[model samples]
Target: MSIKIYGDPGSGSLRRITSAAAVMGVEIERVNIDLFKGESHTPEYLELNPHGLSPVMVDGDFVLYESSAINLYLAEKAGSDLAGTTTRERYEILQWMFWSGEQWRVFATLTFDEVLAKRFMGKPADESIVNLAAAKLRAGASVLDAHLAKHDYIVGDRLTLVDFDIAGPFSQNERTKIPLNEFPNLVAWQQRLLETVPAWADTKREVDVRIDTALEAAGIKL
Candidate 1:
């Protein structure tokens, strides 16, 4: 049986898992969960993921939550090298995934939610919150930029699950008002991935279209 994923199409976490599955040649059945309508808080979704987060994966009797973990699971299931070929490589990819979730996602989410996501929810951006989060995001971007300067991909020369995991948020940089121009290496790395990685490029295109439509419906101009 094909894996089934429950999430809204516009969800960044959802996009991560879908992008990974795409590159790994894993087919998934996407089940929409309208988070804006509080669908995720329902008992059924909560049963699958107590945290009520998007991108819950179910494969037969097995169930999994957390987008990063789902992506890793899909990679292994598909026998894809993205999970890493060697022990050290797998751990290194894991390290980056952990960092992306713990460190990068924190600031990125805050900035995006405040600057753009709030508007979609019929709320105004919190200037104070946006300022604080933007500052932190810039600092985090600096660290990533430095790393990208030494290597093309997050882990090594080749793309890995961690790259898809981390790049999901960056795809929304423009909407979130992230200053990619300040970090040349980071910008170049993102461009390289978009141009070279068909899975990510395709997923990002679809995601952008969905978000843009939502923004338009929300009466948000940009």
Candidate 2:
């Protein structure tokens, strides 16, 4: 069966699937939906993802949206251990992935708006909002760092889809200046995952290429 993913390279959410594909050596069609140009709201894309979000996946007739959900599905479809090998392992993986979305995503978005949006997109950032977000983000980062200090991976000693869940946003720390210096374990965990996983490196390079292509096509420089 063929798989198709619709997203943009610069998207943190979309990066989850693209990087996973690179790790698994999975062949999936990539459909660029440039939110920069309001491509996600167009009729065709809205039909595919009613929420008009990035990283929508279509496997045969099955349509999936939300990057976290798609990560679980992709692992299952590929028979990859990234899904985890047993009931408890799978449950913990899902739990961490869900927390990444429900809990951590808010902080990621906040930092993106306050740091990256202002710096890259020239959008105005509200200082009050940035301060609020930073406080919350720091609390969560500490807990994550503590967890990482105890375990090499989210579920077990192996890299799973949960790593992608946690790693994607951390990768943006340099760009967003999200204050990860305090979370050394979290920082080191991300570094180890990227360095050890060949597929992850492939995904990073692929994303760079895609971003360059899109930027050039849009006459935007970064």
When superposed on Cα atoms, how far off is each prediction in RMSD? 1.5, 2.7
lDDT of 2 by residue, 1-222 (tens): 779899877777777788787676678899877766778889999999888778799999999998878877877777888888999998998888878877787787777767554544656678788787778778878998889899888779788888888777665665566667778898788778879987666666666676556557755443
Model 2, residue pairs in steric clash:
none
- Whole-model Cα lDDT of every candidate shown, in order: 0.83, 0.77
Q: Give the distance in Å from residue 75's predicted Cα in candidate 1 to where it truly belongs.
A: 1.5
Across 1-222, the per-residue lDDT of candidate 1 in tens digits comes to 878999987777888888888878899998988876778899989999998778799999999998888888888888999999999999999998888888777777787778776876778988888787777777878998999999999986899988877777776877887665699998888899889988778877777888888777777886
Q: What's the lDDT of the predicted structure labeled candidate 2?
A: 0.77
lDDT for position 189 in model 2: 84
Candidate 1 wrongly placed segments (more than 4 Å): none
Clash tally, candidates in order: 0, 0
Clashing pairs in 1: none
